[model samples]
Target: MSNFEFQLAYTVKPHKPERDETDAALTRQHLREKLGLDTVEHIETTLLGSITLNNSTLADRKREAEKLVHDYIHDALKELRVLSTVKFYGCLMVDGLGPAIRFDILPK
Candidate 1:
């Protein structure tokens, strides 16, 4: 059988302050649309979301991005029926010049 399975959900965010439901809902929607799957897995948000600093350096940009990603995830957690334990692995920047901020999230 394929390794695909279910339990805790892992996802990423590509945008913030979505013009839709709370940021969290936006993240979940993005995942559902992309994966063509329907699920409501509750997970905690650990990336210091919405705490971005103003700067042009790579580090500053990464911090900004990660926070946004986690914020959306946080919102999604509220819509879930069964909540998973949340943990924060850390943050990383998107490859190349995009420097998209991504929060390292894990289901505990």
Candidate 2:
């Protein structure tokens, strides 16, 4: 008896052509189809060629990513449902091999 949406963002890394396409498809399927969203909203991703350069700008980049993630989810939830109110939270992981910066929204 609940409706929910999830936004998953992940750092982009160099990949072989096949692997890259496969990864993208998988991410879309899991986040959109699995969650049953009408559409998969834009995923905020930055193209920092070297992981080292991104490290220096990590804080700023992450902040921007967070803002986009929240806004996308907030708007989508509002348009999708008539809820009393919707709640949102940004999930971040500083640890290596962490998940892409994303928002988990619950609208009821």
Candidate 3:
């Protein structure tokens, strides 16, 4: 089992009429189902938008997980037909080891 914590800062190009709570709920559900994440929480007071994920199998492999998430977000945006961009940051702790890996995503 792996412990992963992710912090995502994001912006949707065209704002939608839906409330932030509704958008957050939908995003959480989508990520939980698509990535098998145990936790997906939307953080308030973040610039534009933010989301966090904790304790997930997705972080079993640190580097791989980072890449997976980066690519996943890209594909998800395309799939949703939404012009959005995300800046992903994460810290992976395996078996109680503190901060095994810390990374930030950069545009390709």
Candidate 4:
């Protein structure tokens, strides 16, 4: 299993400012389910949000995990129209083998 810590930066449509919290909650739940993550949390304090994904087989590889997360967010945006550009920085835990591999998933 692999653990991932993600720092999320996203924009919501201008008109939907009031739904920010609701949208964020729904996004977190969606990611948890879609990624089959054991744990997902929204640790947002600043304008940027921090998310940690734990115990996920699907996220075992850094490159694949980045693509999966990016694609999932793209698909989720179709239903959750409040989301605009979404970007993230992901750190893949190396299980004490060495330093974690860091990757960035940027908006298209």
lDDT of each: 0.40, 0.41, 0.42, 0.45
Using Cα atoms with residue i matched to residue i, what is each candidate's TM-score against the true structure? 0.35, 0.35, 0.35, 0.37
Clashing pairs in 1: 24-72, 24-75, 24-76
Q: Tens digit of lDDT per residue, candidate 2, span 11-92?
A: 3221344435454344334435443334424644321111111323546555555565556545554554422232334464
Cα lDDT of candidate 1 equals 0.40
Tell me the lDDT of model 2 at 60. 59
Clashes counted in candidate 1 amount to 3
Judging by TM-score against the true structure, name the best candidate: 4
lDDT per residue (tens digit) for residues 1-108 in model 1: 111122223543322224323444544444455433344434432222123344577565555545645555455553542123333333433433253333455443
Query: In candidate 1, how many Å is residue 96 off?
Result: 3.2
Q: Which predicted model would earn the best lDDT?
A: 4
Q: Which is the better candidate, 1 or 4, if ranked by TM-score?
A: 4
List the candidate 1 regions with Cα displacement exceeding 4 Å.
Answer: 1-30, 34-54, 81-108
Residues 3-108 of candidate 3 have per-residue lDDT tens digits of: 3345443433223344243444454345445544444345521222123344354444545555555566656645643323333343434333245455544333
Deviation in Å, model 3, residue 30 alpha carbon: 0.9
Minimum summed lDDT over a 10-residue window in model 1 is located at 1-10
74, model 4: CA deviation in Å? 8.3
TM-score of 3: 0.35
Which scores better on lDDT, 2 or 4?
4
